[model samples]
Target: MLAAHGFVEAVEQLASGLGVSVLVLSLLLIPVATELPEKVNSLLWARRGKDTLAVGNLSGALVFQGSLLPALGLWLTPWRPSRDVVYAVILTLIATTWLRLANRSGGVRPVWLLVNAACYAAYFYLLTLR
Candidate 1:
C-alpha cells in the first residue's frame, strides 16, 4: 500500500530519517520485520514444546533472506544500485553468509548475534559517514 500510494519514498525517507537520523534504522528494521512472522511461528511452536519446529522455521527464514528475496529484488529493480547501496548490500551478503555458516555448526552461537550487532553498528557508522 505504501508503494502503491506513491509514498514509498516518503515513508522510506521518514523511516530512514532524511540524513538527520541514522539510516541504520531502516536497515535494522527491515530484517526484524521480515523475520517477525517466522519468529511468531517459532514462538508458537516453542509454546507447544516443538523446539525443532522453531529451529526449522528459523532455517527457512535464513534461506528466504539469503537467496530468494534478494534474487527477486535484483530481477525486479530496473536500475543498478549506487556504489553506496552496493556497499551496503555487500555488507548484508557478508552478514547473511556468516549467519548461514554459523547455523551449519548446529546452534545459534553468541558470536553470531554479536556479528549481527556489529553489522547493525556498521550500518549506523556508514550512515554517519554518509
Candidate 2:
C-alpha cells in the first residue's frame, strides 16, 4: 500500500512538473500498470483452455476496479469530480444496466457488441476531451 501510494505521488508530481493533467495521467497509466499482470495471467489461462477462468478474471477485475477505484477516489480525495467524470460515470452505469438487460437471454448478440464498442468509444472521447 505504501509503495503504491509513493508511486501515485511520484506520478502526480511528474505530471505537475510536465504541466499535464493528473486526472488524465491517472486514467491512462495507473490502471494499465496495475492490470497488465492480470491480463497476462488471463491470456495464459486462455492458452491453457480455461476460457471461463480467463473471462471471469477479466470481468471481475473490470467490476472491481470500476467500482472500487471511484469509491476510493471519493473517499481519499476531495471528491470534486469535473463534469466530464460525472457524465462518464452515469454513462457507465446506464451501459452496465443495458448490458445486464441484454444478457438476460443468456448470450450476447452482435448488436450488443457493437453498442459496447460505441460506449467504449464514447468513454475514450470523454477522456481525450481537453
Candidate 3:
C-alpha cells in the first residue's frame, strides 16, 4: 500500500512536470502498467500455441478488473458517471459485443482483435478532444 502510494505520487509529479492532468496521465499509463503482466503472459502462451490458456489468462484478468474493481469503486466512492465514463462504458460494450459476435460466427481473426486496439485508440482520441 505504501509503495502504491509512492508510485502514485511519482506519477502525479511526472504528470505535473509534463503539464498533463493526473487523470489523463493515469488513464494513459495505469491500465497498460497494471495489465502488462497478463498481456505478456497471454502473448507468450499464444506464441507457444496454448491458445485456450492465453485466452483464459487474458479473459480472467479482464473479468476480475472489469467487474470487481468497478464494483469496489462504486461501493466505496460516491462516484458519479461523467461523460468520459459513459463513453468508456459504451465503447467497452461495443467491443465486447463485437468480439462475442465474431467468436460465435467464426474464430476471432487477428484483424478482428485490432478492433480492440482501435477502441483504445478511440478512447484516447476522445480524451484529446475534451
Candidate 4:
C-alpha cells in the first residue's frame, strides 16, 4: 500500500502540473494506485506463511490514514480538508465500524465482504461525482 500510495503521489504531482483538479486526480488515481501493493503484499505474505502480517497491513492502512497521516499533516499546516475528503473519511469510518462489529461477534461473516464492497462502490461513486 505504501508503494501504491507513492504511485498515486506521482500521479497527483503530474496531474497538478497539467492543471488537473485535485478531485479528478484523486478519483482517477486512488483505485489503481492503492490496490497494487495491497494485492502484492497479500500474495507475498500468504506465500511466506505470514498471514498475520498480510492482514495487519490491510487494517493498518486504515489506522495509519485515519490517525497518523492527518495528524501529522495537521501539524505541518492548518489543514482544512475539502468536502470530498470528508466523504472519504466518513466512508472509512463506516467501513471500520462494520469490521469492528463483525469481529466482536466471533468470526467474520459474508456480510462483511458485501459491506466492504458497498463502501468501495460508494466511495467510487462519490469520487466520480467530484
lDDT of 2 by residue, 36-114 (tens): 9889999999999999999999999988988887789789988777866675677767777888888998977878877
Output the number of the TM-score-best candidate. 3
lDDT of each: 0.75, 0.82, 0.88, 0.78
Q: Rank the candidates by lDDT, best first.
A: 3, 2, 4, 1
Residue 8 C-alpha lDDT in model 4? 65
- All-Cα superposition RMSD per candidate: 3.8, 4.0, 3.1, 5.0
Q: Give per-residue CA lDDT, model 1, range 1-130, as digits (tens).
A: 7553554465467766654443444455567766899999999999999999999999989998988987998898886766557657888788888889898989778856888778767766776675
What is the alpha-carbon lDDT of model 2 when measured against the actual structure? 0.82
Highest lDDT: give the candidate number.
3
Clashing pairs in 2: none
Residue pairs of candidate 4 with colliding backbone atoms: none
Candidate 3 C-alpha lDDT tens digits along 20-111: 76776877788898899999999999999999999999999999988999799899999997877777788888899999999997689998
Cα deviation of 65, candidate 1, in Å = 3.6
Q: Which model is ahead, 1 or 4, in terms of lDDT? A: 4
Sort the predicted structures by TM-score, highest score first: 3, 1, 2, 4
Off by over 4 Å in 2: 75-78, 84-130
Better of 1 and 4 by TM-score: 1
